[model samples]
Each structure stands twice: as structure tokens, then as C-alpha cells.
Target: MDTSRREFLKGTAWMGAVAMAAGCMSRQSAAAGGASGAPMHGFRVAPMKRVRVGFIGVGARGTPAVKRIAQIPGCEVTAISDVNPARLDAVQAWMKERGLPAPKEWSRNGDKDAWKGLCDSDVCDVVYSATPRPLHCPINVYAMAHGKHVLQEVPGAFSLDECWETVEAAEKYRRHCMMLENCTYGEEEMLAFNLIKKGKLGEIVQAEVGYQHDQRSLQYNPRDGVFWRIDRHMKHHGNYYPTHGLVPAGRCLDVNRGDRFEYLVSMETKSASFEAFGQANFPADDWRHNAKMVKGDINTCLLHTAQGKTLSLIHNVCTPRPYDRGNLFMGTKGIYRSYPSLLMAWEEKVGDGGAHKYFDEAKAQKIKEEYRHPFWKVAGEIAKKVGGHGGMDFVMDLRWAYCLQNGLPLDTDVYDLATYSSIVELSERSVNARSSAIDFPDYTRGGWKTAQPFTVDEIDMSKFGFTS
Candidate 1:
């Protein structure tokens, strides 16, 4: 199973972009969605028949997103593009197995310059952008300007300006732009979000969340190729990856358009390791990668919601601990923690409302019939039956299809992405300036301070005091 020439070239492109030679369009996310030659979201006043999807990266995140999205009812994965030519081999295999058309792939061989143009071709109505963090803004801006909806991977874009440009392009072009923060669809997070929305967590006063999986080994592996994360560590500080942990927590907390997050402070620990173990394990040809990255450690950001609620956010990639998302939410009545037993409270004896009283007789009996995180309420047997990242992945894929089917704004949009990601991009400014409170930019620079929270057919979060 060696890479064919085309595959090798594509892989090289992916590595180049991922390696920072090109700047991140390799590992973030990519997918084929909707149908071909149709309008996505606000393309036209009248609805288009389908949401044709073109995925721009078939590597790690894109592959899975494509695989799962293939299960969507009306979506047609029209095309794919990647720096890693070899990745198409896998895409071809998977598509064949599913009895679908093999999408045309853009590679260096086809035309070194064709990858960017492929995004704007008549073949797709939307582009699922799973490129690296740095490339997000450029690719998204390009796609939106060219009249294509974009579903970018997490953290949306690396810089605040980039975030602004991308979203501005989206609105200007009237294309739907969604930052695919899948963790929000995670069963536990969803359950927590719904519980809070349902008023289960009475008046959330404070919360905690993080992206705390120790990826030290993976991030430095030569076999894993180069990554833009190195650039962040080598040149920056503050919350490294905030969107994954924050989006879900923010959803439950309702930190949106006007319900904004005020300025806060951040503190960091030490760096992981200066030398690349992967480069050390490999040959002199990889010597270019052996260098000291200048990022600080264990990013801990404390935030104060406009409503005076408190939040603790952590982002760490270099640690030797069991995988943990570090989610804990405290309201006037109870609290919720993600790991080490997934639930917490001030003792069930004091239950004013919410999932807290599921233990007490009076409240538990009344709420017995409520709908839980559609997939997570019962993680064992039910999640196993439905499959797909314990069902959150399925939820994400399904919702995209559902939105396309109904012509609605996506569940997670550009504003939500900025709310969560601006923390990382601006935290460095905040920290370097001695924890000076950094003001979040209103990219909507259009009257978004009064914008509405995104909602779906059945999910309404206002009941829990999110109206603030």
C-alpha cells in the first residue's frame, strides 16, 4: 500500500500547508454536503433543491466528516481537494464501498494552482473546510466571496482579524458560514446544554471547561507530519484551543451576540518540550523540524459573562494525564462536571430545579418524561445502537442535512465561533499587555449586539434565563 504519485503530491500539499509552509488547510475539517449547483441558506429568496458539498481536505478530520455526512439523506459529495494525494485512495475506497460516485480530486498534478480554484468551481454549492487553523480565514473568505457556503473546522480562524474577514465575507456574499464545532454536539455537552436551557441548572453563576487531552506524543510525531499548532506554541500564548471546550459550555451559558463575554485574565504554565521527539526519532531530512517552540503552558483563562457569571477555561496539549474535557458548571442551585463521574451537585438535598433534582422524589417524578440529550441521556445501550461518536457526530451531520432540507441558519454560526475562538487569539494580547482586558471585536460591525441566538426546530434555550 504505497502512495500513488497523485496521492504523494496531495499528501505533500497537505504536509506543506499543515507544516506552516502553507499555513493550515490540512487537518482541521472538510466534507461534501447538500446537493450540487444549489443554493445554500441565503443564496436566493426561493429555496434550492439540494446542498451540493465539496470537501477541501480528505485527511484526518475531513475523512470522518465525509464518511458520516455520506449518511445524510440528500447530500452529494461532489468533489474533494487535498495536499496529500494519497488520501484520495482512501476516499475512493470508502465511496466505492458505499456505492457512490468517486468525486474528482484536486492535486498538485492536476494543476499546482487548481486547489484554490476548485473551491469556486460550478461543481459545489458549499465547501466543508477542514484545513488547518491558519488557512481557515483565507479559504473561507475565498469560498464565501465566490458564492459558496463554508463549514469551517474549529477555532474558526487563527487571528481576530481573520475571524472578522471570514464572517464579513459570509454576510457580504449572503452565504451560510458555520464553524463546525462538533463538541457542541457531543452527548454530554448536549445533555448539559439542554438541561440548562430547560432551567435545570438554576441561574448558572459560573462554569469551567477545556481542551485538555495531552496530545504531546501525537503533535510531535514526524509520521504525523508538520502542524500549525507548532507555530502557535513557538510564537504565542494564552488559551490554545478554546472553541472545543467553550462552545458547548457557552451554549449552556448562553454567551452569544448581546449576551457577550466581558474581558478577563489568563495565566500559563510551562512549555511541553522544546525538541521534537518525532524529528529526533527520524532522519536528518527532518532536521528542519527540530526547534524550540515558544508557547507557554497550561492555558487557564478566566472569563466574566456580561450577566456577571464566572467561567474558567483551560487549554493544554502537553500533559501526561487521562483524557479530560474539564467541564464544570455551577448555578444558583447546582453544578455539573464532565469527567470523573460526569455529574455533581451541592448534594441532592438542595434542588431548586434542573437535572440536579433527578435524584429527589418530587422533581424526579415530574421530569421523568423529559427528552434528554437525544443520544447521551442513556450512553450505554442506546448510543451503541445509534453509533457515531456516541451519537453527537450523528447529531451534527443530521442537523446540517436538516437545516439544508429546511432552509434555516445552521445551528452553529460564525458569531458563535468568534465568541469561543476570540479568547485564544486575543488572550496573548491580554497576557502580553499584563492581563489587560481585551475587548472582543464586533465583526458584525453591523448591529449584532442585538442579534438572536441560533435555534433549531425543537431546541429553545430561552426558558432557562438565557434571554439575558
Candidate 2:
């Protein structure tokens, strides 16, 4: 309701394309013929499915997703939509540059409504919503209502009501509504999961992960670059973008699908960064944008799983920190993290500052080798060939199609999205209540216990046709 809050909110329309184009972090397809070297059982992955896709808000985060999806076989981007005519043309131009056909046509609607063509049109069966945080739920509900599946960008919904609303819509529509959270498929994170799963790390008891990017200057990033995160400076806190970091760590720790997030408490530092900027830019009535414009240090939210394990998640955009996630995994046996490098079971002695303290090349090699994912085990060499974020973007796109078409469950499913999102909502509540313990609401309604852990079976690598 305040002016500063409104400042970040106003640009959602203009930057819808830019934000969608950039994507929330980035995702992947493995190459044909699994790579050989390691000695493991037949870890055959299921072939990806072909899901016809339509895209909405192809701007910031959407641009890259469009490009990435196009590269992914089976899934096709049949339609694209955005409110800005210029943006529509821009996306078309990008498509042309990529040698893809131009979309059917451009449908224009006035400013009051989103470009609902792609979502409403029957031309596509699935819609990927890459708009800001606030629109995540609305667009998803719209797509599902129209009998279409939806893959929404993260921080899944802005509020608790929207969360429940999304689950309800999916139930009513009987359509797939998932958060396209890509971090779960990352190489290192998955490696951590494999190591932990094998009991190499012992009874894994606690963890930490986060989105540590610094975006203080995001406010002035051209007309087309504004996004939900910038506006959120004033709305709520707890580095809401925790999904990117947490999803992978959660997989590593088996949160939700295995271990469940029972309760969480959050605390956000004051918005000293936003206040300084407001003082510099606005001389009069800056207080109007006050609360919405800032949160102090970082939005730190901690969660305790139903099994009594604890994990800390940090989400912050205004601070200056290296972009990193997937942190220290401490168990009764050892700890594992990827920022500096990889280490493993008894690879290093405790108190020598952990793995970094006792770095061993042979142990590191074994750690890396032992935990390669099914996708990585088969396509490491090829992923480098058709690379996008270490080939993860490609693998994620293919897996999405593979899961839906074949009727397999996605590794990152609706509950994963909901639970990851709950961390954000609960963090906001925690910060607002003077850092109180905001009990997490089961966004899944009553579906938590029955959810499946995301996995894959024997994939048809013949399609991508592995080389090397």
C-alpha cells in the first residue's frame, strides 16, 4: 500500500517479458547412450515425455526458458504471450533468430489484463508462467481452470491463501500444477543426496541453503527488467527466493517427499539497504513507500522436519554476496558441501575446519564420482556439448516432458513447490511477528503424507543421441 512498495510493483507489467526471459536461476536433458566409467547397476533413466507447452510472461526469466525449452526435445513451445506488444515482437524476433517458426499471432489486450492468449488458447496443453511472485498463483489458477497444466516460477505463491487456492485449483481441475524449481537437478546437490542416501554421511541431522545474489541495483534495470523480488523489498521478507537453494538441499535431505518440514521460524534484518537508497533517490515523502521498500539484514528462516532434523534457509537479494547455495550437510558421520569443493565420508577429520581443512584430491575424486546422478552418469560429456548451466537446463526440460507424457511423477512436484514456498510465507509471518515461530501450514491441505519422492526410470537416450 505504500509508495516505495508500489514503485517495485509498477514495473511488473513492463518487465514481464524480461523477467520471464531471464528465468528463476536456470534447468536440462542428458545426452544419448549413458556415459560409461563408473561401475553401478543399470541406472536406466525414463525417457522424457512430449508435452506441448505455451509460455506466458516471456520476459526476464522467460526468455532463457523459451530458449532452453526449445532445445529440449519432445516439449515444444507452441505459443507465447506477454502484455507488451514490443515484447511479443521481441520474443518472436528471438524465436526467428533461433530458427523456430513465429507463433500463430499476436493478441493484444489493454493494460488491465495479462496477455491471456497462450494460457487460454487450446493450442497448447501446458503453460509455463514466468511472471513475478504475485502473479504466480493467479496465472496458474487461470491455466488450470482452462484445463491446462501449469509450471509456475518459484516462491510459488505470495501469500498463504494463494497457496491453498493453488492446491484447490489443481484438485478441482485435475491438472498438473508444479513449480519449475530447477535447483533440485543440479549436479552437486544431487551428488550430496546420493552420498547421504547411501548412508555415507550417517544420520544426516541438519543443513543450510539459500539464494545469496545481490540485486540492490535491480530497481534501475531498464524499463523491462523489474521483477517481483525488487518489489518484495517492501512487501515481506525471509529471502523468499529460498526455493532455488532449498529444493536441492531438501532433495539431499529428503524433505517433504521423505522427511517433512514440520514447523519453522523466521527472522529478517532491517532494510538498511532500501532505506539508504530511498534517502538518496527520494527527498520528499519517501516514508510512503516505507515498510514495503526494505528489510534489514537477511531473511533467515529455519525449519524443523517432522523427523526432528533442522535446516536453515537464507533468502536475500539486496545484500552483496557471491551467488551460492547447497551448504554444509552435517551428519553423525561427516559433512558435505559444494561451494569450495567436494569432500566425503571420513575424507577429512572434524575440527580441521571440515573438508576444506583436510582437502584430499583422491577423496574428492571419489566423492564426485560416487554421487554422479543418473543423468550425469550418462551425459556428463554431452551436457558440456549442448551446455546451459552445466546442461541442467536441458535435462530439466526433458525430464518435465518425460514425466508428464509417461505419467511419471516429477522429481520436483506440487508438494515440493508448496513446501518450499511455505518457507517463504512462514518467514514473512515470522519477521512480521517480531521473529516469532510461524507454524507452517500444510499447503498440500491433506496430501502431504501421500506425496511421492521425485525419481526417474530407464530413459531413451537414443533421442538426444549421445556423442563422446
**Candidate with maximal TM-score:** 2
The per-prediction CA RMSD against the true structure, in angstroms, equals: 11.0, 12.0
lDDT of 2 by residue, 195-308 (tens): 777776777888977777667666524366545456666655565677887877777666665567877888777667655654565646644234346455577888888778
Q: Report the lDDT tens digits of candidate 1 across residue range 252-277.
A: 76666456676778777666444544
Query: Candidate 2: deviation at residue 252, Å?
Result: 2.2
Looking at model 1, report the run of 10 residues with the lowest lDDT sum. 22-31
TM-score of predicted model 2? 0.80
* TM-score for each candidate, following the candidate numbering: 0.79, 0.80
Off by over 4 Å in 1: 1-49, 108-113, 222-224, 272-290, 346-371, 375-388, 445-449, 453-468
Compute the lDDT of residue 203 as modeled in candidate 2.
Answer: 78
Off by over 4 Å in 2: 1-50, 97-99, 105-114, 222-227, 277-292, 343-357, 385-387, 445-447, 450-458, 463-468
Measured by C-alpha RMSD in angstroms, how accurate is candidate 2? 12.0
